[model samples]
Target: MKCPNCQSENADTAKFCKKCGTALSKKSINHEEMINSMGNTKSGDNTTKIIIIALAIIAVVLAGAFAYMFMSGDSGANDSTSNTAPAAKNTTKVNDNQEKTASSEKTAQPTKTSMSILGGSFSTGSADADKTYAQIYVGKENAGTDVIVQIYYSRDGNSLNNGNMVPATVHNDGYLYITSADAYLYYPDHATINLYDSSSNLMDTQSVSLSPRSGTQTF
Candidate 1:
């Protein structure tokens, strides 16, 4: 026999341990109790394992659901982008081609006039409410019996066509005048004045030139 309280060896008929005063029991009964306790412990272990497996399965299911939601949203965005990409590319190509074509256009030429200058001048003077005083001269005399002055500066893009001509004073072999104007006229110096016959035919068919002189205002 063995003492149950102290796990000590003892005589089979002993009611208590001789050395430690502990109770004794049969070996068969102890063995049976140990087997039963081992069975109960194994059952408890199985229950704990089942609980842990259930929690793991739930975690896996939640993770899979979240992954599905993320993938679906990403798929929708990709579909929208794919649909718009082709149109955006086409528009870019069209704009680039238009820019290249516009850049290749030809440049234009400018028109020129056949204007001749008889003489030009800048002098001191002023104008009234409707007219301005101008100075004009010619380097050579007209060959024809009579000559008329046609002061043709431009006004508003057309010939001054005031249709008025100032007659040369015909003095000292040089033509001089303090004329008037209602047209495009400026006198910084060297302005182009045209010489014409009474019928407005251009004179000085051979050649024409200008000379410089100082100016003064004559009331």
Candidate 2:
């Protein structure tokens, strides 16, 4: 037997320790119960450590997953922006090319040539009764010095003076005049004027009718 309050030897049949005067019992001296309690406590501590380790691992895994997702999202956004940038650039380039093509076509067109007779008149020489003259106000565009003007006279739709062409002389006031020296006419009632360019191409024509007058007249 052993004392419960203090470590001491006693007789197997003794109820109390002689050295310490402590009563001993079989239940108090049982070593197996103490060993079992120590084992249970150690097991509980191990279980707690395992739970904490598992929780830490789970937290680390979650953080890693979140970081990967964030990085992937950023990469996707960058890729989208890169792709859109090229498309926008290509669109702008195509628009510029189209505008340039239209501009070039417009620039390639040729200018038109124009010539016209603005006004005209008919006259007779006072000194010579058989001689008549014609005068016209000429307006022209892109014309040169080689441009020519001529006139033919008639009476009552009947050709006179054999439909002779009377060449005209240009004046500083933008008027062309046919002198008696060019053609001789006697009381002409109608006239035809023709204009030609340097290339001998007929540019314009005009007709005039003369009212009965004593001398010079405008038509």
Candidate 3:
């Protein structure tokens, strides 16, 4: 051992220094104990510092994960909202198109009118036996209106004299009739009678055969 007061070397069993006559055992033991305590303190401080650093790193990682998850959830909600907006707009457009289609269908309906021809006949005139006459019966819709009749006569597939713009008159039977005594000199094998309204619009046409006088024509 070495004495602390005189810096002199001594035996391991000596309790006092030889040159300074000072105690050596207690001083050496105290110095060794102080060094051990300082080493333990340093070791404990290093361990605490490492644990604190590890905890800080863990806290930072957890915070970043939470923030990422929050951002992701928010982005998902925004995307859903954006997607729903277009769907709603599409639904509205479809509804508008359906309404427009229904409106067009309603407007495209045809109108109803009351204009028609009932029947007609071709016969010899009673007042003038040698002349032929045509009688056309019109519907009640032509009442109080002037009607014109045109006759197209054909004999043995040959076209003959045709009568046009023959005015009709209403009779006691509450119907309009067309009579033309000089419509044709000879009886026609086939005759087509065309009736026109007051505006000169062709209303109806009828084919008649005058070969058999006994045959009565009906609509």
Candidate 4:
């Protein structure tokens, strides 16, 4: 390039004459245009840098979230795996408790019976140990009604010896006497009395179900 004011030779990049310091010509490029271009370039570069920085930050956040979720899931899975024996042991304990409960239920079923006759009421005897008399007042039984009577003993109602119902002497007042001393009476529990009717039927047999006084025969 040439400096027009001083007629001096200068480099192409020169904007003014080296000799008199005058502007040589319109610049090889417009100053304002260059400044605008530089501004545009700087803006583009800054935009690209910001985009890269944002991408890097997003990547780091994604990686951290993925690691947290993966670690949490793996920790839970490992914990479950490690506790298998205790879970199975707990199941076995529950099964044992259920078995014990079942055994208790089996023992809770109805108990064995102790009564010989289900509803029949019986005798009250003397307090003396040697002279224990066994009798229930028949006059008070069934409101002292004068009626035909029957007595059942033991479990079965029809058998001859073990379970039996027999005819009893009836008074004019209608009191049923299963055992009358006037008729040589005896009870079924006492085996020693060998008395009998002239027909030789067993006479010493007890007629009714007896409830004893004092001391539980309590089941």
Candidate 5:
């Protein structure tokens, strides 16, 4: 190539003549085109860099949002668990208290019972130490109205003496009496009584022990 302005000979690819500092004819145009191409390439590189940077920023933003949502969900779950814990505890406590109250009520209820009879004996004479008289007393026993009772006495195991119905006794109080004065018996005697109700139901079988007469004996 040759520089037209200064008529200087130069290399074909050179833009300026080395001898006279003049521009080469075809090299000047090629150099300007290369500069424009380099500028355009630099602009395209910068655009690609900007796009990549924008994508990285968007990815960072999306990741931050996802993390925040996950944290919030965990926090909500924890809060829900915490809130329900007391309710569950209170429900259990109430159930326990109700069970305790039911048990207490069952414990407070009275047991069922039926009619009963009790008996005692004493001496009839004033000074003689001989057991003579006997009584079967009924206090407020749990029976029906005007509950009739029959008493049978046995001095020995072989014989039984049946007595009359005990005075049409109410549930409140009554008595059945036996006396050696009527039967001519003596001391240290023992007797057994079998009691029955109006329905012929056997109520009780009790034994009476008569002690000899003494001044200090407590009946």
Candidate 6:
């Protein structure tokens, strides 16, 4: 027989181990008990494995949920930012257009009156100091006509001042400029001016008492 305590060879009827002095029968291991212990260990190992697998699955699920939330939040923010960009640009464009239209309207405003005449007689402080000269200007509505206009200035009953008749030069926009300098050299008295066309057709005639504000006429 073998001693259970020291695995020593002994007599079959011996009750103790010769090498370690241990009682052989007391230290003997039962085959059934060892089998039961191994089974318990296998069961514990499987339980631990199942727990580890469950924890790993839970961790993976949590990570996926967190990633989904983060991605969703980031995507929403980007969408909001992109959506507002065009709206802001459109608002600015609308404001700019409105301002431009207001400016155009302001610039396009028309004049109040068509024409106004301003001229009068005045004394020249010169060698002819005592002599008062007459000046006249006639202003009226311009129809943009393509015709010549003449201003026949008569002083002392003659259409001559310094031996010349006042002629009005017509502009492209129908404005007339009296180009005769002698027209302003007449003495202040009763005078008549006749406006005639190129065909010698009388258009306007006015008689005036030459004074400071006597001939500021408008038509």
lDDT of 4: 0.46
For each candidate in turn, give its C-alpha RMSD to the true structure in angstroms: 16.9, 8.9, 8.2, 14.7, 9.7, 11.3
- Superposed Cα deviation of residue 130, candidate 3 (Å): 11
Candidate 6: stretches off by over 4 Å = 1-29, 114-219
Top TM-score model:
3
Q: By how many angstroms RMSD does model 5 differ from the true structure? A: 9.7
When summed lDDT is taken over every stretch of 10 residues in candidate 3, the lowest stretch is: 124-133
Q: Per-residue lDDT of 1-219 in model 3, one digit per residue for the tens?
A: 777887688887889999999977744854555788999999999999999999999999999999999999999999999999999999999999999999999989563222455776666533322455556666554456566777777777776665667776445453765555454445567778777766667877777765633234453
Between candidates 1 and 3, name the one with more favorable TM-score.
Answer: 3
- The alpha-carbon lDDT assigned to residue 113 of candidate 6 equals 28
Q: Write the per-residue lDDT of candidate 6 for residues 1-219, one digit (tens) a residue.
A: 566656677665677778887776745654555778899999999999999999999999999999999999999999999999999999999999999999999999574222323333333333322333334343334334323333344456655445234444444444555444542444434445555554555566555544323333332
Each candidate: what lDDT? 0.54, 0.70, 0.70, 0.46, 0.59, 0.55
Give residue 80's error in model 4 in angstroms.
6.2
User: Following a full C-alpha superposition, what root-mean-square deviation does model 6 have from the true structure?
Assistant: 11.3
Q: State TM-scores per candidate.
A: 0.29, 0.48, 0.50, 0.36, 0.46, 0.44
lDDT of 2 by residue, 107-151 (tens): 895743446778877777553255776667774433233456667
Better of 1 and 4 by TM-score: 4
Best candidate, lDDT-wise?
2
lDDT of 5 by residue, 46-88 (tens): 9999999999999999999999999999999999999999999
Question: Pairs clashing in candidate 2?
Answer: none
- Worst window of 10 by summed lDDT in candidate 2: 139-148
Candidate 1 lDDT, 1-219, residue by residue in tens? 656666676777887788799666554345545878999899999999999999999999999999999999999999999999999999999999998877765443332222223444444334212333444444344222345555443333444335466665433434445455442343222233555555666764222122222344221
- Write the candidate numbers in order of decreasing TM-score: 3, 2, 5, 6, 4, 1
- In model 1, residue pairs whose N, Cα or C atoms come closer than 3 Å (at least 3 residues apart or on different chains), thus clashing, are none
Native-to-model Cα distance after best TM-score fit, residue 138 in candidate 5, in Å = 3.7
Q: Which of the two candidates, 4 or 5, achieves a greater lDDT against the reference?
A: 5
